[model samples]
Target: MGLGLRWYHFALWAGFILVMALMPEFVSKGTLRTMIFANFLAIFAISWDVLSGRTGYISFGHPFLIGIGAYTTAILTKRFDVPVEYAIPAAIAMTMVGGTIMFLPALRIKGSYFALVSLAFMELIYQLVQVIRPDLTGGTRGMSGIVTLTRGAANGYYLSFSLMIIVALSMWLLMRTRLGTALSAIAMNEESVKGSGLSPTKLKLFAFMTSAFVAGLGGAFYVHYLGSIAPRALFDINFVFTIIVATLIGGASTIVGPMFGAFFLTFLLEYLRPFLPGAERYLIYGAIALLLYMYQPKGLYHIFMSQLDRFKKSGDDD
Candidate 1:
């Protein structure tokens, strides 16, 4: 059964890679640019999934970790003239360390209180970025003139797409392990995991660190790709909403679900832009999200899985 599961997983990803590889031949440059954003968004959403979706930790402040990565790399490369190669790795490590520190409060708190603490962390960072070390942070204007990883839509698309696929595949594999089961078990009931003699503290710490690592990696790479960083953009609640909603709408607990959700949300928003052309579009989008979330909190992935099951059953009968 394990072998079969591995085969199924490998086949799905292999097919996805084949399709992504071929997509450039048929799509326009403009569409490819949008797809690149989708890829980055998917990576970030998957990062969120490792902890919040899997362990029920519900981090409202993941942007805090992401910001740490972006800011660290940006500050190092811009102010210190550190090489990009070393700075990016340092950024990721900093994000994990910062995340572990932030998560210390969650060790003592749970549920709503934990969520609030995370939210506060994001706000705190936002304020600090504006006031602290205006020279290094570039003040309210933030940093521009940063280096981009690739030029043109095609190269950018492939880079982001490859990164997203690698991150998603690796995360999917991790979640299939016993550690994954233990994390999920803690999500279901922390007390129960403790009763089983497995420390929930240790498991939660593992989940937070893993989530931070992914978020940091995605965030650091993203800043370099865009070649810019700003506090308002990185630390916004709307950004948080998009990440969380994408994960939830895609089917929170599964890695693939958030990837699906990110693409779907990206395309949906892009399609709406021409029609509404303003902030009002978000109102409509938010409404749809709320309605769907209220009705089927499990998300589109759950619906897709159910439909697939029904189709398989009908085919078997025939």
Candidate 2:
């Protein structure tokens, strides 16, 4: 069954909004800067969870779709002299089309085959971008001095958080509808869903498109926020791992899990930065992530849920 929002959900969100609104009052700029990364990570993770996490169709090439959005916007605004407003929407449309192309294979295959193909797609995009047009793509160095959405960390934090909140709530609410149930049903048993007279292909396409939309939105804004875009950074495997790990460690198939997971993973990285600076940091971060994954594969959200269940049971017994 699809998850339903409860009264507590409203209260929880309201409290979250209040806290976010007040965050700058107490935290240092450095922390807020870290938070801005977390917010963007959350967005990327949510984009990931929408298709791969929920539908059980793991997309190793999610960064591919995101790259489409980021590159489209970057190229449009930088080389073509297009305005930011138009570039962003154009990026979204491009991603949707890219997603459809990616989704086509799903109609025929899945699992390892699909995963490998998606990885190839990402590599294909990465190679093509650098070689296709050195003049526009800036060759190996990547394009810099792009337009920025916000000036300082504080404004950036607010902007990112607002988008995060909107995406989280919107996706969460959408998943509560019947469409969510159908998508999950497809994930669980596509054959069964088909037998039930539902069109699995159509449902899967919708999920793909939805994931693309979020990826595009996040990527377009993320590039603008950073004021730069690069093929190597956008298509890197580490970026893919981070998104997958955040979603898995946050509790896949749950909207809140990815968001929470993104922040948790980001802070973990920040905390370990001192002890393990530079590329060495991922070693400790990877180890901690593996331990957490082993300890609670269902993620922090599942742990909280199990504890909550036990508490309720104990109260009833009492």
Candidate 3:
């Protein structure tokens, strides 16, 4: 069943895209801008899900990979005068290489130790970018006036939305393959996977690379979208917290879950702006997220599936 595909899956995805594509027509430009952020967040959340969510690795420093991509492109475009077309691809490659180098060592450990090592990697990069080459990295202040992919809220929303959909669809398809199952099995029981004659190391390497690819893609595009990059903003704990929370709240081990979770978290924050227009909004936002997570640890995805199943069963009874 892991490899199986159903008509309803395609139908559901199509319906969702249709609805989202129509959003620009009805919502205000400010709301569209907010959605652009949501689209990017979804991309980041999905990247996190691919590695930590599926493999049980639980990386606390995903932004480390993201920062690599952002900095690579920013430096290339701003300092070296490289064309964006070349710079973005270079950014992705650099991020993958960086992620592999940083994460390969930590793979030897497990659980909280692995998490700490990843966090350390993030902190390491954070300090390195600021001190190693201030001119290239723009030091702590970061680089601005980077190339932007689109203009106007409407155009930005479409670009971001398109990228988010492509990433979501690609990942959803990938996770249905045999390799995905192997990676997932590693999460459930590493020893058992080894016993089954699969090399857990190779599987993990593949998963890590895949996650880094997505992170790099998202990070590169994200910086381009914003036309700037700051070390503090990219490497901050709050940023890490948001990405992990969105993935968990949406449902781990599922692609669509994180996408919806990103939108949900973004909109929730926007909705609270009027009432608590400061840091206080985060308090209430975090509380609501905590409550939802507590009530449905499996995430909104499971709740939705349960309701669908229940409705099907009721129709059969009738």
TM-score of every model versus the real structure: 0.96, 0.96, 0.97
lDDT of 1 at 197: 90
Which lDDT tens digits does candidate 2 get at residues 41-136?
999899888898878888999899998898899999999889999999999999999999999999999888988998988998889888998898
- Residue by residue across 1-318, what tens digits does model 1's lDDT show? 132274655787889899998888999998998999999999989999998998888889989999999999999998998999999999999999988987799778988888899999999988898899999998788899887788988999999999899999888888887888888898899999999999998888888888889889999989989999988889988889889988988989889999999998889899999999987877877888898899889998898888988998999999
Off by over 4 Å in 3: none
**Full candidate order by lDDT, most accurate first:** 3, 2, 1
- TM-score of candidate 1 to 2 decimals: 0.96
Per-prediction tally of clashes: 0, 0, 0
Judging by TM-score against the true structure, name the best candidate: 3
Whichever of 2 and 3 has more TM-score, that candidate is: 3
lDDT of each: 0.89, 0.90, 0.91
| Candidate 3 whole-model C-alpha lDDT, 0 to 1 | 0.91
lDDT per residue, candidate 3, 1-318, as tens digits? 476889998899999999999999999999999999999999999999999999899889999999989999999998999999999999999999987886687558989889898999899999999999899999999989998989999999999999999999999999999878888898899999999999888888888888899999999999999999989989998889889888888988898889989999899989989998987877886897789889998788888999999999999999
Which predicted model would earn the best lDDT?
Answer: 3
**Relative to the unseen true structure, what is the C-alpha lDDT of residue 310 in candidate 3, on a scale of 0 to 100?**
100
- Cα RMSDs, all models: 1.5, 1.7, 1.3
Candidate 2 whole-model C-alpha lDDT, 0 to 1: 0.90
Query: Better model by lDDT, 2 or 3?
Result: 3
